[model samples]
Target chain A: MIDGGYQGKILRVNLTDHVVKEEALREDWAKRYIGGRGYGTRIICDEVDPKVDPLAPENKVVIATGPLDGTTAPSSGRVMVITKGPLNGTIACSNAGGYFGPMLKRTGYDMIILEGKSSEPVYLWINKGKVEFRDAKHLWGKLVNESDQLMREETHLEAETMEIGPAGEKMSMIANVMFNGHRASGRTGVGAVVGSKNLKGIVVRGNLGVTVADHDKFAEAVRATREILAQNPVASGGLPLYGTAVLVNIINSTGSMPVRNAQDAYLPEADKISGETLRTRNLVRNEGCSDCSIACGRVTAIKEGKYKGEHGGGPEWESIWSLGAMCGNSDLDAVTMANYLCDRYGLDTISAGSTVACAMELYEKGYMPAKDAPFPLRFGDADAVVESIRAMGEQKDEFGRLLAQGSYRLAEHYGHPELSMSVKKQEFPAYDPRGIKGIGLEYATSNRGACHVRGYTIAAEILSPGLDRLAYEGKAAVTKFLQDLTAALDSTGTCLFTTFGLQAKDLAQLYSAATGFDCDDKEFLKIGERIWNMEKLFNLKSGLTGKDDTLPPRILNEPIPSGPSKGEIEELDKMLGEYYSLRGWGKDSVPTKDRLKDLGLEDLS
Target chain B: MKVLVLEPAKCTGCRACMDACSFEKSGVFNPLDSRVNVITFHEDLMFVPTVCSQCETPYCAQVCPTAALVRNTTTGLVDFLKEKCIGCKQCIVACPWGSIRINHLGKEIIKCDHCSGDPACVKVCKAEALTYVEVEDVVASKQQGVAQTYRRIAAEMVKGVNP
Candidate 1:
């Protein structure tokens, strides 16, 4: 009996039996967990076995959209996709923003649970209150763009779709699920899990309208939130003008750009692959997700040169860092081409580029011979980066196979596990942990393997320049608070970028107005803490311990060689004890029974 | 006279304009219900906003059998009148831009009516992709763009011969 801000329907599709079941969304769960990532993690923890193979039929993939979705709330377009990650063997909660999320919500369901594996390639077509399992043999090997066009043609409707490309079909661990053909639920190998289910795509055409509890109150809350977003420089000016790639020169200047597979922290030619360069040379225009005032999505083009006419949504800040500085490639055109191909082939650009960087390091170290690679692999080889990404997407050869296993395995194969620059079998994003100590702690303690979005301390540490990023003293508390807030925001189905301008109180106001739930600031933060602990409980049950909450030896031991943070190693251990204590976790990094009882997560424990 | 103008180059294809238009017009947030459409050319890395040109001789108004589509003299917009609409969709078939859409309940075929002169789409367009400007200014701005391209080519030619 969900009242407002919810469709009150949970649609579960069992691929094995081709059965579609509609069940009542639990009101208690909705009130407690909210929705989106909260709904996903709880459902996955209940349904999936800890020891089950991520790609196995027993595993379930839950797609959850929160109450604010399909509403006029600014940037409330994010959709969370939760599953066991094939890459890191951890609970994966990946969020993607685009039209697909709103459309999915409009289908009169708050969540869609995908269960079992289909024997043949198939796609789910969900219209308003009706679900159909359609044959997708024709769309199996097609890339996202092509498959999207095909699906639209087949459906004869302007359907919002989430599709996978060749990379996912081939089961690349770095594969990502693409929404609206470009925006992706990218991290932790969610696409590979979809591939394992033999699901080609999910096309949704929703005609029903989403209604609010009190339209006037909701509108006022949205107005206040949008006003904050409009006034914030990062949200309104820098983001809209330069997209996320605006961080390139700034992060590079701080010596946290992670150049040449963390061998160096700065790229000499950083400006060449900067947001300023992209705006002047390659920018087609700035776009945004549905109802997003901060149009941070870059539509860029390679106007001339070798990779001429190549264009796509981005190589955002992280992608640019992974494909450019980290690989020592300064050519913006090459980076843009790699970005397009990654989107086209449905590959996670972060893992794809980071793995290539690892291989480049292996090649330079004389560990990976030239004969083993399709071409001579070297740092700053722009064309090599472009081709290798395509090769990895297409699973080109033995080289492609090696690259598909991701950096951890690739570096381990060369007998240098420490050189992989990863944690928990997942590659780290652009930020070098050594330069930003708070980020290092966040990465180590992140429930998911190494990821920046889980808790983006960069906003305070480097981007805002408000905090002492070099000192690790009070960062643990900051990191833990951010992580909880982020987890809660992820549950609310809003883009994490909104935090740049609006605070938890703003979102809480919006939530209460939309759903008629009377939640104060304390209750809001508590909900976030509860969600974070629930995820930790799931991980603990899955056999992850305090020992697993750690960064790689390179990030912890190696001093950043150049730039502002020169000769500084990450003090992760200094923060871990505080972080664990603050999180109400024991010395083993597991939530104690008493702590779980406090959050009402004792059942999960 | 002023008219809604679209600069495809300025569009990021975020669909904020679409969402706002739909919400304002229909009291709901749905991209498909928006009067304006954003056509994404993903491979080419471009977004072309397809909006009502509000032409002098609108095909939609001309094709409407019931005179539901009539030009509003004040705003120079071909506004839709719900009372006169027969739900025949003749205007939908005739519009070249495909900007007209059937409302969620399938009652009226609605297009951009400029919201009685203060267009919601234009008001929310952050990229300035959609604007309401005098008709002559639109052509003047376009010509300036063309002139700049020609001037650049001419300068290049002069440099090539002189050097």
Candidate 2:
């Protein structure tokens, strides 16, 4: 089953016919796309109809795992869920890391592709070599935790379940299928596709373990990775202790922690909602993904207060920004509770909080009366934040429905679309691109709308790659390289955080060993470029263009007003030109024929 | 009498015990198939590991239909002999604490042997939950736990519980 240590077969579950078929491995596609988000986008764009309504039953959800998956490789417990997002209305490929990917790998399938809507609410169970769809009508409209509980009861505590909550079942655009309690596939709203299919959840359990083709060599590579990571203080020392919350004070001090929905470039409440605060005050424990040593995933709980018993899928940096500063809510307990609600309801905290923020601005501006709206939905209202999150879970009432659609559509409905901090219908994150130019280019180019994790540029523009600081001139070159590197990492199903310690050459070396393909650094980088261009081509074919590559009006028009990044505006026109030129794209930002030919993609398009 | 001395505060929930037992018995890494189960009541962020006490009157070994399981004389470890085992899961049902499990997928019965003398799980546990302390020391640990609880209550007092 493994030539290069892989399951060799991808499972296709046609929910419409209740068909669970095992398909042969596509060696060529695996070679070109690698896996995870890379293969996800390629398969979706080529196989599924672009015109299929994102929320409709016809749309397909192809869950992909990479070649490195199930190995003792760090963070190989990652998987990608790809479909048309109701939030962005584009190619939504969201990646998550936990025990699920490894379990699926043990179940003897490289990937699981869910196609067509089922007759009724049902969940697919994969037990070692067995696969089946069982009735889930009784479990419909449950939260992610509730679904997990029900499935575990039915499967007798043997299965690890991945399920969406009521928000997904209701087809809420910002929904995510939470993995366990602390980790999530927290972006681009793939949960809506899961909901649309009437597939409530997927539970997998297996006793089988993977065999690395060359176990001795694989062991060496894993050890080398640990050695590299051990030196990078960020991954080994800092992240394990503080998690990604390590960025809070730094991003704030640099004026990159976007506050009050990007109107302010820094959060004054930086100390309250920071990673340090989380560690000292709220952190209950920390855990790792399958076989990972860096256990950065935080388990936090609010203790001894009104928000007592309030816990988290732990508030990540983006969650801290979106639900914390973006809404002007500083109460740490409330922020933790909001984070909990997002995971419980299986909603994306970024889109949910920013959507509510957009409405808050509108309400403040007298665009809508508070009486007509749900709560006094104003900025900095803690009660309102909690209530709005509850309403999102319920998926009832007019205001909740609007917020469920995410910020882009919510603002557009009020004829104040410019107020929405978004690109491609997904809301922008904490980094105000106007303050930092490279992130602006990255947001416009990211396949899944307004995503930062897709290609984070804060490394070069703010926190510098080699711990160097603040270089703007050569950032275009740096961002381009990192973004492609990120694309490659996602394809390989490795955590993007690994890039902090692991060099491209190491990744290339590991990739060759894992896939049984001799891919040099150039070959790897080409695959990354190919995925990026393929995603761009998917967007283009799905009716997006260079015009769409433009940032939100506020980001383009406004300066930081006052901060370290004050007087700075996004040099978008200049950066986009150079980026497109380097990417071998036309003036319209579509990949040129020459670029496709060069990347061995001529046969593809 | 022998007993498990568990320190709740020190537990990190690495589940190394499950790995060690499954590896020796099934020759695979499976937490589900392990005998000494860690009942992690995660809402409390607490790990309450349920293991065999190796009681003076062993209920499971006493009631085994095939007499497949028995308490060792020298070490008092509750060991299961696969050759003697009929795959009848009577001991699993007879045990009150649920520290026994059959292979969930393979349908083969399993239980903890505590590694004869030097227990592998106890040695491997980063948390030190499974200690191979002297049989007499178990009483002293229980006395220490009670004394600590009394100190905690005394520290918290302005008033005692009303009669």
Candidate 3:
């Protein structure tokens, strides 16, 4: 048995055979991989075949949390859902913050591996050591909030739930798995994989405690880090006061907000839908995830519009941009309503809004037939924005089904795939790569395709004092370093926001105290480097190559039309080769055997 | 004497207080063992962090068969003595607010002792939802909060008439 930070059990559920078995967690693998994304990806790489279809029964979903989960370590409540994603058939891992991760840890298991497919719709109810597979046929078509309530009524009242809505039920490629009906594992169609298995959701509750190896040391580490976070202006002041929507004004001022499907990089009236505006008009209160002190979550309501009384958790910075500026709509009410719809229907807001923006462009350019659209699909039409979200969520019509396939497929069908503003068939987020150069490199090299959280170079390029947003020099090394560090941090079950105040050494201190492992900053970062290489190897085996590592043509070729970054374009080619060299990859962007062996992955190579 | 004051509007439902309390009491992190609990009503967007009120006429102390639950006059806290108690669970059943609960192991009763007069929950509460302050200061601060709201309303009235 392990000393602490692990329950030493892995729960494996085979839906096909209806078997629930408890397997001992591999101690050696736990030591090396750590947990969450790292350990979950290791299991996937070992058990799953790269060539298998992502929606097939052979594709397994590993729901994992790290050693810090359930501990008093600040914001240590993130859970990762790792699988062969249906979005691009890549190894996808999406994490969300809530009570689910800590509750799962209390269930006497470090991870839950879901295998095979069920003949009928079902949900898993895990109460401490007991596991129950219950029929969910009656609840199959319910929305996220309704299903969450129903599942909890069936199980314990206090049980934490993770479920999907109609998007997942229909296996939309941009589906999300929502926890507590609000927090989303919101990328790369992990929800579609869950739906393909005919599993509706999982409810978990337990009474066990998570013990640390050194209690005094862990407490001291937590106290120090908490003080640091409390003192940091971004963490304690801006975030709690205005929420992440604060970035709307900050990024817009920098001319990187990606307005109107990235036809332009800035919106002149951006502050109308910014964080400050949201707070003054719509905010009811601030909320937070479990164990988090920096409560950046906005509990907002539309008070006096047609969508009045519609309230929910957030339309955070990315969602605000995607639904507001990307659609060329300055109506905050419409944006907030659409954000609620995305969460309720279990859709990834970034992909959903971006896809709609592409459709609008297609319609406006006369590429898409007027007969194909239910109404005039024009930019800045608030009603159309709301209607389109409803259509995509419910799949109400033929046009809705087409839109649900995501922007890449939708744009390709319209005969101008270049208009999709995406990389590797996944849509770009709020930031325009043309304005911010380092983030462009990150999006190109991201294992999960065009994701911001994989490596947020924006922290360096825009938020912090390190790098210039418009420059191409020195971006390669920063991107690589941030990517590696992020890979490790995501595994630790801590919020990425913590990095604003806490450094690598602080994280190492917490991890070492909890797990009884003496890890310094260098070793901690090395573990992250190992995970990055492992993910790259998985992508290579799945047939992606150096040629696939590229930004959208629009970002690389077009200059911002107006604003502070009016003449800027992303110089990705200048950074990619240097990034590859820094990562110890070959010129073709593949990890060398020597680097794999150095990371202790010789056998896999 | 000091009392634990809970301001429900300020709680974010992070449950850091619960984790701190449980760890200080049991050396492990579990909300089930926590003396303080943040009850969440997600639909209403409300969180109430509940703790023992340490009532002057303690129901738990009166109900205890062995007098294991007693009110400490110095700290104004309801102290639980494990050694003096039998596992009768009378105090658990008699608690009107349900502040007292059976341990996770179902062996004995557990209630907030205010961390022996230095509450761990208050120190870690970043939201300041839970504050341990002198009893006399609590009402004064609460009244000041209401007066500020009235002052804002009166200023708004004046501006409306002038504009």
Best by lDDT: 3
**TM-scores of chain A, one for each prediction:** 0.99, 0.97, 0.99
| Clashing residue pairs, backbone N/CA/C < 3 A, model 2 | none
Stretches > 4 Å off in candidate 1: A369-371, B42-45, B51-67, B72-79, B133-163
Q: How high is the DockQ of candidate 3?
A: 0.79
lDDT for each residue of candidate 3 in B1-163, tens digit (9 for 90 to 100)? 8889999989988899999999999999999999898998767567899998999999999988888999888777788889999989888788898889777787868888877679999878988999999899998998999999988888988889633
Report the CAPRI category for model 3.
medium
Task: Kindly list the per-residue Cα lDDT of model 2 for residues A179-242, writing each as its tens digit.
Answer: 6544578788889889999999998887765555554455567667756876777777778778
- Per-residue error for A217 in candidate 2, Å, reads 0.2
lDDT of 1 by residue, A1-605 (tens): 55478888889999999999998888788878889998788999899997789999999999889988888687888998998888888889999988788888888888999999999999999977788899999998898988888887787446888999988988898899999788999998899999999999998878777766777787688778888888898998888888898899888888888999998897878999999999999987777787788889887778999877666688798889888888999998899999889988999999999999999989988999878988888999998899999889888698998898789989888899887878888889989889888998888888888989888999999877588878888898889889888888889889999999988889888888878888777778888889999888777777788898888888888888888778988878898999889988888898878878999987887
TM-scores, one per candidate: 0.93, 0.85, 0.99
Order of candidate numbers by lDDT, starting with the best = 3, 1, 2
- Note the Cα lDDT for every prediction shown: 0.85, 0.76, 0.90
What TM-score does candidate 2 get on C-alpha atoms?
Answer: 0.85
DockQ of each: 0.49, 0.14, 0.79
Q: What does the lDDT come to for candidate 2?
A: 0.76
